[model samples]
Target chain A: MKQFSKTLLSIGTALAILGSAAAVQAETIKIALAGPSTGPVAQYGDMQKIGVMAAIDDINKAGGVNGMQLEGVIYDDACDPKQAVAVANKIVNDGITHVVGHLCSSSTEPAADVYEEEGVLMITAASTSPSITEKGHQLIFRTIGLDSLQGSMAADYIANTVKPKTLAIIHDKQQYGEGLAQTVKDGLEAKGISAVMFEGVTPGDKDFSALIAKLKKENVDFVYYGGYHPELGLILRQSAEKSFNAQFMGPEGIVNADLAKIAGDATEGVLATAPKSFDQNPENKARVEAITAKGEDPSGPFVFTAYAAVQVMSDAIKAVGDTDPAKLADYIRKNEFDTSIGKVTYDEKGDLTESTFLVYSLHKDGSKTPAAQ
Target chain B: MSEASLYFLQQLINGLTIGSTYALIAIGYTMVYGIIGMINFAHGEIYMIGSYISFIVIAGLLGMGMVALPVILVIALVIAVFTASTYGWAVERVAYRPLRGSNRLIPLISAIGMSIFLQNYVVLAQGSRDVALAPQISGSWTFGDPQLFEVSLSYMQLLIWVVTVVCMTALTLFISRSRMGRACRACSEDQGMTNLLGIDTNRTIAMTFVIGAALAAVAGLLLGLYYGVVNPFVGFIAGLKAFTAAVLGGIGSIPGAMLGGLILGVTEALTSAYFPSEYKDVVSFGLLILILLFRPSGLLGKPEVEKV
Candidate 1:
C-alpha cells in the first residue's frame, strides 16, 4: 500500500510538471480582457478596454504575479451573448487563467456559465444585472455593483429626496433597463410610493410624445427611466418641448456626456443614480491625478474598478504562487484585495461585500454634477 | 375611455409626423429601385450624412445666433438635400455603376460595403459620441378641454412635417409629370428599350440616385430636429427600417412607399406604447412576414408574373 501511494504521488508530480510546461511554464502568466470592440455600445467596450488595459499595464510594471510578468490578450465579443460564449470558449481554449471583463449584461451572463464550468475566474468591471451573479458562479466576480443595488438606491433617493407624489417609470426594456426599472419600482412600492404610469420606450426612437403625454396628464412629479442615454435624451428634449415639465430620473446609463448633448438644457435638473462618483471623492484625488497624468480621464467611477480588477487578479496569482486556473480562482475568493473603490471582499456567490451609489443632476451647459447625498 | 382616447389621438399625431419623415425616406428607396431595380442599400447613410451636414451648418448658425427659426429650417433642409445629392451621385459612380449589370447579389454586396465604409468613415471623422443638435424651433402650442390633457405642436415637428409633405408632393409631381420623370418610368419599364431611345440612361440613373438621396437627406434633417441629437452610426437601424418601409409599401411604387412608411411609423409608435418598446422592430418584421406570406406582392404591389 505504501509503494502504491508513492507511485500515485510521483504521477501527480509528473502531471503538475507537464501542466506547468504547457501553460504557465513558471516564467509567464496570461490574462484576457473581453468586451464589445465594435457596434452600438462600443463606448461601454472602450471603458472595459481602458479599465482592463490600465490595470494590466500597472500590474506588469509593479512586478507581476510572483516574478512572472502578467501578459494580456483582448477579445472583442461586440457585446453579443452568442459571441460572448464563443469568446468564453476561446478563453478556455487559449488557457487564460484570469479575465477582467465581458462588458454587457447579456454577454457577461452567458459567459459566466462557461467560466464557472471551466473554473476560469472572471472579474468584470461593468455588467450590472442582478441575475448575473444569481446563478452563484464563485469563479465570477464583478467590481461594479449590480443593477438591483443601484435601482433600489435610486428608488430610495426618489422616495426620500425628490418626494414626488406621482412618479412615472419608463424603460428601454433591455435586461439592464427593464430589470433596474422593476427593482426600483418594487423598492418604491415597499416605501408606499406609487407610480402613476409605468411603461417602456424603444431605443433609437425619434418620437416620445405618446409616452411624454402620459406623464403630462398624470401630472407626474418624477419620471424614472432605466435605459442608456439615447432614448433618455430624446425623452428629455421632447418632454420639455411638449412642456411635460416632470423631473427625469434614471440609472447610471443616463449619466453619460451624450445626455447633455442630446437633451441640452432640457436635461437640466434631471437626476441619475450611479456608483460613487470618483470626481466627488477627495480620497480618490491621487488616483484621478495618476490616471490624468497619463492623459486619460479616471473621473468615471468604473475606471477605478477596471484598475482594481487587474490588481485583484495579479494579487490572486501572487497569493497562489502559480497561474493555474483552479488555484488562482481559489486564491481570489479567499483574499480581500484593496481596490480603487475600497477594500473589496467577495462572498461565496462572487458579489462584493459592500456597495454604494451616488446621484448626479444634469446641467444645461453640457455637464453633469453629483447631487447632494 | 376619454383618457385612452386622448392618448390614442396624441399617439396618432406623433405617429403621423414620424410617418411623414419615413414616407420621404421610403420615396427615395422606391424611386431608386424603380429606376435601377436594385435596392440602394447606401440610401440610409445618405440620410445620416444629410443630418451631419445640417448639424454642422446649424451649429455654425447657432454659434452666430443670427438666424430665425424659419430661416434655420430652410437652410438646414436645403443644405441637407443638396449635400445628400452629391453622395448619391458618388455612390452610383463608385460603388454601384461598375457592378450595375452583374448579378443582383453583387450590387447588393457593393451597396452594403458602401454603407459600412461610409458609416465607419463618419465615425472616424467625428468621434462615436453623439453630438447635441439643439434645433431652435422648440416652440409649442398646447390644447385640451381643461388643458389637463395637453398636446404640443412644436415648430420643429411642424417644419419636419411641412418639408416631408412638400418634398413628397414635389417628388410625386416630378415622377408623374416631368420629362426626367418619364425617362425614369421608361427605364423602370425596360432599361434596354429606354437605352435604345433618346434617354441618357446613365444620367437618368444618376438623377434617380440624386433625387432619392435628396429625399433621404430631408428625412435625416427632420429626424435630427425631432430627436435633437446626431451620431455617425444613427443611420443604420433607421435605414433598415426605411428599407423595410419601402418593401412593405411595394419597393418600386411611389404612393405605396408613402403608405408603407405611415403604416410602419404608426405600428412602431403603438407597439412601443402597448408592447415592450425594446422589441418595437419585432412588429415591423412581423408585419413584413404576414404581408409576404399572404400577398407575396405586398399591400399595394401588383403581381409580377415569373418569366419562366
Candidate 2:
C-alpha cells in the first residue's frame, strides 16, 4: 500500500511538469499599443488601434509568427507626455518587448527613451515631428514620414504650384505645430517667397478676429496655418467673416472632417498636406478590403501606416526567431520589409528612407481629394 | 476715410461684438458678487452648461425633420435659459448655501471646487473635443470699398449686440423698478438686517444666482452660435476675462460691468491690431490694473467709506 501511494505521487508530479512545459510552448507574444485612447485626440488613436487590430487579426489567423499567437495590450496616454512615460514604464514592467504606438509627437518623444533604455522595440505610427527620430535611437522606428518632408512639400506646392506673392504663416505655437510651421517658413524662404506675417496663436482661442484683422491689413494672397482643426476652422470662419479673402492651407493637423463641420462653407477650397492615405494606392486594395471588412475605416491617415508598422514588426520577429527586443530592433533597421502601405525601409535616424506628402483639396461635401499633379 | 481709419473702425466693431458677449457674462459675476459677496467662480461653468444645452437643443431640433432657423433659435434659447437657471439654483444650494456662515475663504474655496467639478462633469458627460456647429448665421454686410479696408459685420454679430443691449436694459429696469430687485439690493447692503426684516435673504440670494446664470446662458448661446464651436473649457478663459471685466467696471455695479467689458474688449482688439497680437491680453489686464490704481471702486462704482 505504501509503494502504491508513492508511485501515485510520482505520477502526479510528472503530469504537473508536462503541463508546465506545454504552457511554456503555448505562451502568447504580448505587444503594447499605446496612444491617446480617451481624450480630445482619441479619434486619432482609434485609427492606429484599428490598424494594429487588423494586422494582429490577419497574423494570428494565418498562424502568428513562428506559430505563436500575438496578443495586443492597449495603453491610453491621452497624447500627454507625462502619462506616456508612465505607460512606457508599464509596458516595460509587463515584460513586453514589442510596441506599435504613441500617436502624437508630444507623447512619443518622451516615451521613446523609456523603451530604448528598457530594450524594447517601438514603432510610432503617426508622430511626425523630425525631432522624434532625429535622436537616432536604435530601438525606435516610425511608419509615417517626418513633418520636415510634409512641410517642405507644402511650401513647394505653395511657392511653385500655387505661386502666391505674399503669404501669412500662422502656428498654434505648440511643439508639433510650431516645428512644422518653422520648417515650412524656411522652405518658402529658400524659394524666395517671404511671408508677410509669421505669428503664433494660442490653441483653443475662440477669437481670431483681431489676428484676422491684422492679416487682412497685410493683404497676403495665401494663409498657411500650422495647427489642428478647431483653431484653424475658427480662423477660416473669422477671416471669411471679416472679408479677409485669402487662400487657406494647413498641414496634416487640419485633415479632419470636423474642420468642415466647424468652418462650414469656409472649408470649401481649403488645401492641406498629408501623407498618402491607403485608399489612394491601388496596390493596397486587398489590404484595405480586409480592414473595411472588420468594420473599421481603412482610409484614415494613420490606418495604413499603422498596419505597416505592425506588419514590419511581426516580420522582423519572424526573421529573428526570438522575442529579444535588441535583435528585433536590429532586424527591423537592417531589412526592407514589404507592407500593406508600401515598402518599409529605415534610415540611420529610424525614419522612413523615402516619404512623400501629397496636397489634398477640400470639396464642398467636406471630403478631401488629392490635388492633380 | 483712410484705409487706416477704416481698419481702426473695423477692429472697434470686432471688439464691440466680443465685448457684448463679455458684458453678458460679466453681469452674472457682478450681480452674484453684489448680493452674496462671493465670486461664484463656477459662474463660467454655468455659461459652459448653457452652451452645451443650446448645442443639444439645436441638434435635437435638426434631427426632428426639417426645422426652420427662427423656430430652432426660439426653442434653443428657451430651453437653454430654463436649464441653466436650474443648474445655478442647484449649485448654490449644494456648494454655497451650506458654507454661508463660514468665513469668506471657505465659500470661495467651495465655489472653486464646484467650478472644477462642473467642468469635469461636462467633460465626462459630453467630451473634451470641441463640438462643432454649422454656421447658422451667414452673410456679412460690408461698409467699405473692395480696394480700401472693409468693415464687415455678420448677421450673428448683429444679433449678439442687439440681444446684449435688450438684456442689459431689461436687467437695469428690473433692478430699479421691481420689488424683488429692491429686496436684492437690501440683501447686498445688509443680509443680516434684510433677513431680520422678514425679506427671506436666502431666497433673494438664490434668486441672484438664478438671474446671473440666466444672463450667462445668453452669453454662452450667442458665443456658440457666433463661433460655430463650443467646448467644455470655454468657460475657464471666458470666466477669467469676465471676472476681470467685473472688477474693472466696479465689482458690484451693473453699469460698471458693462463699461469694463467693452473697455476690455476694445482695448484688446486695438492692441492686437496695432502691436503684437500676443500682447493683446497684456493690454487688457494692464487696463484693469490702471483702472484699479486710479479708482479702486471701478469705473462706475460708488465710493465706499469704511465704517469704523
Candidate 3:
C-alpha cells in the first residue's frame, strides 16, 4: 500500500514539472478588454470587444508581435466604478500588463487610476469625458476625442452654421450628460449666445411631453440635448408631434442607429456632434471589410477607435520589443501610427494630439450624413 | 392672458395628461390591494406587456395596409386588453396562488420576483433598446396665441383625459352595480365570511387581477401613443409612481387612487415648471412623505380598527 502511494506521488511530481515546462514554452501575451459586457450599455462593450479581438486575430495570424501570440480576456464591470476597480485587480492578478476597455467615463476614471497605480497600461477606446486625461495618469490613454473639444466644436458649429435665434439646453442629469451640456453652454455663452431654457431629465424617463411643452413655450429655434439616443428619440418624436419647429442637436451619445427606430420620421435632420467619421478614411476600407467579414458591424460605437487602440498598443510593443508599461507608454506618446482611423498621436497627457469633431445629421433612411458646415 | 397664467395652464394640461396614465395604472394597485391585502408589484410588468402588445398590434396592422387611425387604435386596444389580462391572470395563478396561505411577506416577495422575471423576459424577447413606435397619433390644439406662452393640448392628451374619465365612470358603476365587484368587496372585507357565504373567493381574486390588468393595458397604450417610444424598463418607473399614487389616494380606495395620481402628476409638472427640473422627482417623493406624516391612513384610507 505504501509503495502504491509513493508511486502516485512520484507521478504527480512529474506531471507538475511537465506542466511548468509546457507553460514556460507557451509564448503568449495576455491583455484584457474590461467594460460593461452586460447591462444596459453592453452594446458599446460588444463593439469594442469585436474590434479588439479582430485586430488581435489579424496581428497573431500575420505573425504575432515579436513572435508572441496575443491572448485576450474579458471582464464585465457593468459600467460600475466599484466593479471596474475590481476588474483592474483581476487583470493585474492575471499578469496582464495591458488593457483595452472601460467604455463609460465613470468606469474609466477610477479604473485608469488603478491601472496607473498598478503599473498597467490602459487605452480606453470610447470614454470621452475630458477629466479622464486631465488626471495626469501616465499609463492611461484614450483614442477618442474629449467631450470638451467635441462640445466646444458643436457650439461653434451651431453658432456659425445653424445660427438659430434661441436655444434650449437639456441634459439627462448624469455626469457625462451634464458635463457635455455645461461645456457646450460655456462655449455658447462665450459666443454671446445663451439658452433661453435649461432643463434636466431623469436618465430612464420615457415621458418628455411636459418638458417638450416647456420648450414649445420658450419657442427656442434649437434644442441642444446632452443625453443618449433613447430619450432623445422620444423627445424628438414628441416635439415633432407638437409641431415645435425646433431643430435638435446632441452629442455622440445620440448617434445610435436606434435613434431612427425610436424617432421614425422625427429623426430626419436631427443633428449630432461626433468624432470625425472613420468611414470617410479611404485607407480603412480593408479594415472595415475585415470587421464586417467577422459578422460584426464596423459602424458601431468605438469599433474604429478600439481598432486603433489595439493597433497603437501592439505596434508600440513591437517598436519597444517589450511589454514594460512605462516603455510602452513612452513609446506611444512619442510616435505616430497610421491606423484604420487615420494617423494617431498622443500628447504628454495621453490624449489624442490632434482630434477633430464634426457635425452629422440623420437622414430619413436611418443613415447619418455630415451636415453642411 | 398673461404669460404666467398661460404657462400655468399649459403645465396643468401637461400634468393631467400624465396624471391620467398614473391614475389608470394606480387602479390596478388599489384594486389588487383591496382584495388581497398585498401590493401587486408585478402590476407594472403587466402594464409593460400591454404596451408591447399594443406596439405589436399597431406595427402589424400598420404593416398590412393603410388603415384609418381610429380603427387601428381600437384594434390595438382590444388586443392589448385581452392579452394583458391573460398575463395578469397567469401571474396570479403561477406566482401568487400557492402562496396565498403563506405569510404576507412571501407573496410580496414572490410578486417582486415575478416583476423581475417579466422584465428580463421582455428584454430577451425584445431587445433592450427603446422600441420606437411610429407616430400613430399627431396634431394638437392651441388654446392661445403662440406669441405669448400658448397653452397647447395635443390630440393624444385629449384622448388620455377622455379615456380616464370613461374608465373611471365605468369602473365605479362596475364596483357599485356588478355582481362580481360585490363579491370582490365582500372578499376584501372578510375572505372567510365571503367563502362562508358561497362566494367563489379564488375566482374573485383572479378577476380582480384581470380587471386591474385591463386598466393597466389602457394606460400602456396611451403612454406609447403619447411618448412614441417604449422600452422594457418603462414599467419600473411608471409602476413606482403609480404605486405612490395608490398609497397617497388610500390603498384600497379606487377614487383615492385617481385623485392621488392627478395630484402626483400636477405636482411633478408644476415643480419642474417652477423649480429645477431635476428636483421634480424629489418633490414628488417629498409630497408622499408629507402625506404619510400628516395622515398615515392616507387622504382617504380607513384607519385599521382591531376588534376583540
A364, model 1: CA deviation in Å? 2.5
- Name the runs in model 2 displaced over 4 angstroms: A1-132, A135-141, A291-303, A306-339, A343-345, B65-68
Residue-wise C-alpha lDDT for candidate 3, range A81-108, written one tens digit per residue: 8899999998888778999988999999
Which candidate do you rate higher for DockQ, 2 or 3?
Answer: 2
How accurate locally is residue A8 in candidate 1, as Cα lDDT from 0 to 100?
A: 100
Query: How big an interface RMSD has model 3?
Result: 1.4
Error of 3 at B258 (Å): 1.8
Write one digit per residue (lDDT tens) for candidate 3, span B69-146: 899999999999999999999999988899988999999998999999999999999988788777777778877766
Candidate 1, A192: how far from true, in Å?
Answer: 4.6
Predicted candidate 2: interface RMSD?
Answer: 1.1
Clashing residue pairs for model 3 = none
Instruction: Evaluate candidate 1 and give its CAPRI docking class based on DockQ.
Output: acceptable
Ranking by DockQ: 2, 3, 1
**On TM-score, who's better, 1 or 3?**
3
Q: Write the per-residue lDDT of candidate 2 for residues A41-116, one digit (tens) a residue.
A: 9999999998888889889999988988887878999999999999999989867888998999999999999998
Quote model 2's TM-score.
Answer: 0.83
